[model samples]
Target: MTLSDTNHAATLALRALAWTLGEPARAERFLALTGLSPDVLRASAGDPSTLAAAIGFLESHEPDLVACADAIGATPQDLAEARRRLDA
Candidate 1:
């Protein structure tokens, strides 16, 4: 992805993470699916790797990905691409 695209993805992923955490149940589900705890999430939420993992987690489940993308005003593909860039 281009640098601009990657930057957009990162921003979208952070928004997606916020959307996920907006609801208690959704945050719990994310934590469970990602094998992350509240403590870890708090500690790493700002880190690129953790942000990428959150996007990757959403991407792994299409329904969640679509929902999250919609909620964050981003395309699912952008979130996925952001994960790839962050992972790299």
Candidate 2:
């Protein structure tokens, strides 16, 4: 997945969400930071706003952003750009 792909933003956000949820503590932190309950998160997983929030969550923390980007085969900038696209 190249950053330029039209669907890249949503895809990357989903992957980031999965990575965020891979660990219980991190997932709890994400939910806390985003004010999203697990049920709401599941229900809105695909919503553009929710996706953007996921990207925003990563963006707010450099370590997680870099780690998630590396884990997902994307650059930190790619994640940032994806957030921009999603926000658009």
Candidate 3:
């Protein structure tokens, strides 16, 4: 996948995680650490900073954050296919 696709996927993953964890604050904090904004957590939805912020947040949260990550892990390929459909 292209960088943009990866970034978008990451954003979607982040959103899925936040939803599962029920901790928007954690998600927001994660984005903030990477100097990212929470608004962009949507798929292909936000700026690079937002993605970076989320990564930073997840890094800080560690094992506690794994639950959220795992929740979305199952859907990445499916998400990619959806993106492809959108592109087509």
Q: What shift in Å separates residue 38 of candidate 3 from its native position after superposition?
A: 7.3
Question: Which RMSD values do the candidates have, in order?
Answer: 1.8, 2.7, 7.2
Better of 1 and 3 by TM-score: 1
Instruction: State residue 18's C-alpha deviation in candidate 2, in Å.
Output: 0.5
Error of 1 at 52 (Å): 1.0
Which wins on lDDT, candidate 1 or candidate 3?
1
For each candidate, what is the lDDT? 0.84, 0.90, 0.48
| lDDT by residue for model 2 (1-88), tens | 3546638789988999999999899999999999999999999999879999998999898999999999999999988888888888
Clashing pairs counted in every model: 0, 0, 5
Q: In model 3, which runs have C-alpha deviations exceeding 4 angstroms?
A: 1-17, 24-45, 74-88
Candidates in order, TM-scores: namely: 0.84, 0.92, 0.44
lDDT of 2: 0.90
What's the lDDT for residue 44 in model 3? 35
Error of 1 at 32 (Å): 1.6
Local accuracy of candidate 3 as per-residue lDDT tens digits, 1-88: 6777665666664464455337766555555554534444454344444433444445454564455456666343444343343343
Candidate 1 global TM-score: 0.84
Ranking by lDDT: 2, 1, 3
How much RMSD separates candidate 1 from the native structure? 1.8
